[model samples]
Target: MNFKTKLLAYHAIAAAIAVIPMQSMASDVEIKYEKFPLTSPEAQQIWAAESNDATPLGEEKPWAMIAKVKVPGKKDLVVSQLFSSMHCGGIECPIKIMQEGLVISEGMACDAYEYHELSDDHEALMACDAIIPLDLK
Candidate 1:
């Protein structure tokens, strides 16, 4: 082919690539959390230590779940939180973030939580009931 035609074809290819999204061009990673019932003896121990037995009837067990978080190029994270009909009252409950069975973070309250891997840093987003979302680093 002539130089002019080859140059035009190269320019067209470059233009198409430039318009494509950066994410689609790279390996796409899905970030999400999965909840599984907390039924292990270890989980029970954690609940007993943190629950404080606030409920009027001590017999009322706190509903709990372990959240497994998946992040790109990282080990799965384990989160412990109370849920269902029996959770700590108001906006706060005991929350724990763990990796490899080791606690990385512990907090009093977070009805909802999310982790973000930003361009230059990482952060956790937490929201309490009836309260504004907090951007935590």
Candidate 2:
């Protein structure tokens, strides 16, 4: 084979090897929620109560929801994940870390508790450990 052709082939193979693991490492997080459409009025109320300073931004309405999930062996674990359109009314919202109902560390933003809105590249359901609507009924 010509030297030019051989060089091109080597580059292509090297590129393929480098790309494959990055694709694998970019794994999709699997999230399971208790219900779809979260239609319960009670559930909506609970979410509203949890939302910290969630007021509508322009025409965009603020919202929240509660999620009941079973993670592997941990059955029926209820963890509240909140959403807000506004930034905590410019207040430093304390992020609580709890284990079995007792706060292990307070005011530390648990990586799991960090909030992000839904987007095309990322699913809100997947981004959050669990999802709660920002509004209550």
Per-model CA lDDT versus the true structure: 0.50, 0.36
Measured by lDDT, the strongest candidate is 1
Against the hidden true structure, what lDDT does model 2 obtain? 0.36
Off by over 4 Å in 1: 1-39, 45-48, 51-60, 83-87, 112-121, 128-137
Task: Supply candidate 2's per-residue lDDT for 130.
Answer: 29
> Which pairs of residues collide in candidate 2?
44-136, 63-133, 63-134, 63-135, 64-132, 64-133, 64-134, 64-135, 65-132, 65-133
Those runs of model 2 whose alpha carbons end farther than 4 Å from true positions after fitting are 1-30, 33-52, 88-137
Candidate 1 has its poorest 10 consecutive residues by lDDT at 128-137
* Model 1 C-alpha lDDT per residue in residues 8-90, reported as the tens digit of each score: 99999998786564323322233244443344565664465645543422454455556665545567666566643345556
Model 2 lDDT tens row, 43-73: 3544433444565534645433334433333
Clashing pairs in 1: none
TM-score of decoy 2: 0.33
- In model 1, what lDDT does residue 11 have? 100
Superposition TM-score, candidate 1 onto the true structure: 0.47
In Å, residue 53's CA in model 2 sits off its true spot by 1.9
